[model samples]
Target chain A: MIEIFDLEKRYGFTYAIRDINLKIETGEFIGLIGPNGSGKTTLLKLLFGYCRPTHGHIRINGQPPSPKTNSFITFYPEIDSLYGNMRVFRLIDWYSRFFTDWNKETEKKLIEFFNIPLNKYVRQLSKGFRARLKLLLSLSRDADIFLLDEPLSGIDPASRDKIVSAILREYRENQTIIFSTHIVSEAETLFERTIFLMDGSVILDGKSDDLREKYGKSIDTIFREEMYA
Target chain B: MNTMEFERDRPIFLQIKSAVKERIVRREIKKELPTIRGLAVELGVNPNTVARAYRELETEGIIGSRVGKGTWVIPEALQEIRKEMIEDIIDKFLNNLHSIGLDSKEIKEILEGINDRDI
Candidate 1:
């Protein structure tokens, strides 16, 4: 379980996120949803320990986020951080050597499913393929928690479907996944719980089905009509 | 299995339940239901949602599962599903008419005015 208490982050004079408290249980698939500049990425960065919270704290399985806790968490950043000059197959080899829990079988399956060109350099691949390679690398690890930041952003609809399918295919029953995305319509069905962030604060947090029952609308509709309105 | 497009206004589990019930009624799913994970993947939904739908169906005696054997439609599920479907249709029809300002009296009058020979 992960417990975040009264978390706050600030950059210079501006607050990125403030007064955030969340408790994520094991095996739960959560959506961190918000528009641009709503601190979705900041919140994910804080969770992954890429940056420290200015106030409050986060505990993963009763331990704080650190290099030790990092082993249990697999983070897929929103940016393209792969080695630009390395061939796809070489990059995969280098990445697999870093983790003892890497599953070669999953790597093979994702490579086939995503149709990634192994001979092409990472910089030479299309945006969609780059995103697929990032996802493949993150999902190939056997980690307890997966933090994916906007895995569907800027991709075509067909590639988005393939990404969603790959995510589902690699989903283990015991793993916890918290993915942040504004593409709520396509991904709404995958979220068991959804947290709606607006202006760096959580405006809504509940089970997806309960939210649907309460509002009589899908999460996407609520996100658009209520949160953005 | 074909991808199912969900209506955005209702709870997804309820929608899934109705869809599965419709399939069972239509004999498209005669013997066994797909595994929760399989159905989840096919529908692009969380497996927990599919599991909830299955659990509700089980509670209603529409489906059953054993340890070794997979989940299957109950023998009398067809009759039970038909009764539920009829109730649902009537409830929806009544609600729709009511929403349009028609009371039970007007509904009954309209029903009585329909010519039997129109068939």
Candidate 2:
């Protein structure tokens, strides 16, 4: 379980996220959606303990989040951190040394499924392949809460399907996943719930299906209307 | 299952349920239904979503599962599912007809008209 109470992250007298309170149960798949600069990334960073909260508190599993909690929590930052010069298989070996929960079998299966060449350097891979590699690394971990930031930001429709399927395959029954994305229509189907943020505040938070049924529109449509209206 | 199409505006579990109900109606699903996990993987959807659909089907007596034996279509599952789904279809149909400015009398006339046609 994760709880955020009156959470705020500020920079130079301006708030990135403000007055937020939410409780996310275990095994829930949540989508954090908003336009650029809506503090989606800032909120995720606070939960992962990468950034200190300016006010209020966030607790994970009844305890305040800390760096030590990194062991059980896996966070995938939006920025690409993979070394370009390293071969694909070698990077897997390096990641295994840090995460005890790394599943080698899943890594091997994903490699085959994505048809990724182990011998090629990361720099030589295409944008789609790079995206696939990033996802493979994230899903390799057997973590409690998976914080994924923009997993579908840049990629063709074909590769997006593959990446989405890979995510579905790696989902464990006991895990809690919160992923942020602006491309709502493509990924909205997989979300159990969604949190709509605007200008550092939550505008709406509810079950994805309930929101759909209430508005008689897709989540994407609702977001566009709320944001543009 | 892969051949099934899903709409973007509705709940995914409903699409899964409709697909399964269609198979049952066509007699494609016999004594045994596919495991929830297997069908989820095939459809590339969350297993929990498929579980929800299966649970609803079970509640309606269209399908049942044992502890270790797995899920299967119940006897007379077709009639059970059809009886439940047809009412919803008719309700929607009537609501749509009304939306087009048709009253109950016009709807009754359309139903009578349907009886005269092959449809």
Candidate 3:
């Protein structure tokens, strides 16, 4: 469970996001969605303790969202900064050595499931393959809370399907999943609950179905009408 | 214990109503559903939301209320609900396909292809 109270973040002269109060319980597949520069990254960054909130408090399992919280939270950043010079397979081995929860069996299975070549340099892999590699690395951690930022951006249908399927297979019942993406139509399948963020505030946060009924549209359309319009 | 876990894109009141309807459909909760206080505690939501959902379901003839006895499923509601669900599901499906630019002929062809395939 995560409890966020009046969570606020700001830059020197401007506010990124503020007055965010949310409670996420166990076993939630939450979709954190917003436009660019809408504080989605800032919210996620605060969850991982990578960035400090100028004001407010965030607690993961009654404690700060930190390296200690790392045991409970696994994050997949929007960008990949893997050591491009190294062979792809070695990176998995390196992570396995670092995070003890690193499941060798799961990693081995994912390597085959993703069909990622073991011998090629990370830079040599195609864009799709690289994305799968990142997913595999994150899932290998087996944390209870996962914060994924835009895992399906700018990908082909097949690639997107593969990523979605991989997540379905890899997800555990006990974990809480908070996934952020811009793709709206896919929300119906990807998440059961939706959070609407605009200009750094949670304009709409409710069950996906109610939001749809109130506006008589999908979450995407309601968002455009409510916040963007 | 985790209200956020199952939160849908729909309104909170409708979710409460749907939960009661689901239990009725499954026969797990045959008759009068739990009181608002009980459901709110069980699901960890606002009491008012649950009450509102129950009120709406009553108006729809899916459930009934006794002045002092409590609430319950209408005896004939099970059959009526099943009948209602068939048309609603079909309508939503065809409308979705049509909205996506598939014509009636294209939809018929797709349906036929599914039928032709071996189970």
Candidate 4:
């Protein structure tokens, strides 16, 4: 369980996300989304405790978000962070050493299913393959909370669908899955709940179907209206 | 389960209700099988959303409760629910059809054409 009380992240002077109060119960699949530069990354990092909030508090379970809490949380950034020269299997081995929650069996299965070469350096992989590696790294962790930032980015439509499906498979009964993306429609099919972000704040959030039912339009339609329409 | 979920400024309970409805229609839930807290915990959804879904299902007669037995699915689940859904859509379909100045007869013809195509 994560309770964010009046959470505020400051960048110099202006607010990245200000005085926002949200409670995400354990096990819910939440899609944290906002427009570009709308603090989507900021909010996620704040929740993940990567960046300090200038004010307010974020309490996960009972304690503040910290490295101790890191074991229970797994974050998948839109970009890559693995060592390029390291072999894929080696990277998994390194991560498993750092996080005891790493499941070797799951890692092997993902490697086989994705057909990721165990011997090749991660840097040699294509952009799509690299993204898959990031996803694999994130999914392989047996954490209770997942903060996936734009898992669908830079991928083609067919692959995007596959990634979304993979996300569904990764969701466990006792965990929380939070994914952020700009293309709501692409992820709408798997969207149990969605959060619409613009200008660094959550402008809309709800179950995906409820948003469509209330707005009388699909999430994509709503995005068009919110951003440009 | 103390999971924090915001409707993110939108109606959340409604979405939950529909998702539960789908499960109920498929008989994936046997009604009153899992308590609200358990369901919320299992689904990783907010307890409020689970409560709302239960409320709506009860109102629509898809599920019911006994004093101690908790919520249970109705035996005759799918037929009535599907019929209800079709009736629910008919109004919206007709309204959209009316917006284009089409009458019931024309709408029926179009639906028949669609049905024929599927067959």
Candidate 5:
């Protein structure tokens, strides 16, 4: 479980995320959705202990989030964090050394499932292939919490389905996944609960179905009406 | 199995439940329902979602599962299930028709029109 208490993150005088209090239970698939620069990345980074909060605190599994929290939190940043110069197979070998729960069997299966040419350089791959590789690396780890930032963004429609299918196939019963995306229509079906962020704060949070029932429309439509209203 | 599609306007488990209920009513579900894992993969939904769908169906006496035998339609309750489901569909259709300001006579006219068509 992740517990956040009055969480705030500021850059100089400007705030990125403020007054955020959320409690995510175990074994949930949460969708964090919003427009650009809505503090989605900041909130995820704060959860991963990659940046310091200006105020408030976050707890992972009842402990204060620190470097140790990284053990169970597998974070896929929105940016391209892979070493562009490295070959695919070599990169896998290097990354597997960091996580203790790296499953070799899962890695082998995903490697074949994605059908990524292991001999190609990471920089030489297309955007879709890179995202697949990143997902392969993250999903192979037996982590308790997964924070994926826009895993489906900037990919072709065909690759989007493949990526979403891969995630559904590999997700375990014990893990809690929080994925942020701007493409709400495509990703909305997979969400049980959703958090809608706006201007650095949560504007709405609830079961996706309840929201849809209340609005009498799709989550994407509700999101647009809420954000634009 | 073909990939089951879902609409984004409502809960997926409800859609899954309705789909299964439709199959049961149509007698398309013969021996057994698909395994939770199999259906989940086919629909690209969480297994927990499929499990909830099955649990609700079981609660409604539409289906049941036994250990190692997998889930199956309740053959004995098929007639009752059909009655309840048809009633539900009619209720929804009538509600929609009334919501659009149609009275009973107009609804009957529309029903007659539908009956004349090759449905």
Candidate 6:
């Protein structure tokens, strides 16, 4: 389980997120949703220990977020920071060697599923393929918690479908996944629980089915009508 | 696996339940229902939603499952499902008629007129 207590993050007197508290259980699939500049990325960065919280704290399985805790967590950043000049196959080889728990079978399957061109250099691939490569690298690890930041952003509809399918295919029953995305309509069904973030604060958090039952609307519709409106 | 289209104004598990019932009534699911995980993946939904639908179906005696075997439609599920669907249609029909200011006498007259036409 992961616990957050009165978490806050500030940069130069501006608050990115504040008064945040959440408890994520094992094996739950959660969606962190908000529009751009809502601090979705900042919250994810804090959870992964990319930056320290200015106040409060987070605990993962009774331990604070650190290099030791990070070993069991896999983070897929929204940015493309892979080596631009490296060939895909060579990059995979070099990347896989860093993780002791990397699964070669999963790597092979995702490569085919994403239809990634192994001969192409990272700089030569399209935006969709680059996103797929990042997802592949993150998901190939046997991590207990996967923090995916906008895995579907800026991709074509067909490629988005493929990416969603690959995520489902690799989902283990015991793994906990928290993926942040604003494209709620395309990915709402995958979330068992959803947290709606607005202006750096959580406005809604509940089981997806319960929310649907109460509002008589899909999560996408709820986000639009309640959050955006 | 084909992704199922869902309505935007209903709980997904309820939609899944009706989808399974329609399939059973149509004989598309003759013997065994797909495993919850398999259907969840096929429908692009969470496994818990599918499990809840299956649980409701079991409670309603529409389907049954065993440990080694899989979930299957009950022997009398077709007739029961048909009856339930008829009830739903009748309820909607009555509600629509009531909303349009038609009473039982007027509804009976309309039914009689249709029977007489027989065209």
Q: In TM-score terms, which candidate is top?
A: 6
Q: Which order, best to worst by DockQ?
A: 1, 6, 2, 5, 3, 4
Residue-wise lDDT of candidate 1 within B1-119, one digit each (tens)?
35689886678899899899999988999999998888888999888888899999999999999877999999787998898899989999889999999999999987787765484
Cα lDDT for residue A153, candidate 3: 81
Quick one: best DockQ, which candidate? 1
Residue range A5-59, candidate 5, lDDT tens digits: 9999999989999899999999989999999999999999999888989999998
Model 6 residue runs over 4 Å out of place are B1-3, B66-68, B97-102, B109-119
Candidate 3, CAPRI quality class derived from DockQ: incorrect
**Which tens-of-lDDT digit does each residue in B62-107 have in candidate 2?**
8889989999988876787777778988999999999999999999
Local accuracy of candidate 6 as per-residue lDDT tens digits, B18-93 = 9999888888889899988888888988877788899999999999999889999998879989999989989999
Cα-based lDDT for every prediction? 0.91, 0.87, 0.78, 0.75, 0.88, 0.90
- lDDT score for residue A45 of model 6: 90
Q: So what's the TM-score on candidate 4? A: 0.71
Candidate number that wins on TM-score, 1 or 5? 1
Across B1-119, the per-residue lDDT of candidate 4 in tens digits comes to 13333343345556567666666666676555477656654554445456667788788877887767788888786688777778878888889999999988998899888986756
Per-residue lDDT for A165 in model 4? 52
Off by over 4 Å in 5: B1-4, B66-69, B88-119
Superposing every Cα of model 2 onto the true structure, what RMSD results?
A: 2.9
Second chain alone, TM-score for each candidate = 0.78, 0.78, 0.72, 0.60, 0.77, 0.84
* Model 2 TM: 0.90
What digit string (tens of lDDT, one per residue) describes model 4 on residues A1-229?
A: 9988887888898888886778888878787766788888888898788999999999989788899888789998876788998998788788778787888887877777677888899889887778777888889889999988988878876656556656655566588888888876556545667777777667777777577678877677787788775
Candidate 3 chain A lowest-lDDT run of ten = A183-192
Residue ranges of candidate 2 with Cα displaced over 4 Å: B84-119
Model 1: per-residue Cα lDDT at residue A208: 95
* DockQ, cand. 4: 0.09
Question: Which stretches in model 4 have alpha-carbon errors above 4 Å?
Answer: B1-119
Root-mean-square deviation per candidate: 2.8, 2.9, 11.8, 7.6, 3.1, 2.2
TM-score, ranked from best to worst:
6, 1, 2, 5, 4, 3
Tens-digit lDDT track of model 2 for A41-142: 999999988889999999999888886677789887789889999999898788778988898888888989888889999999998898889888888888
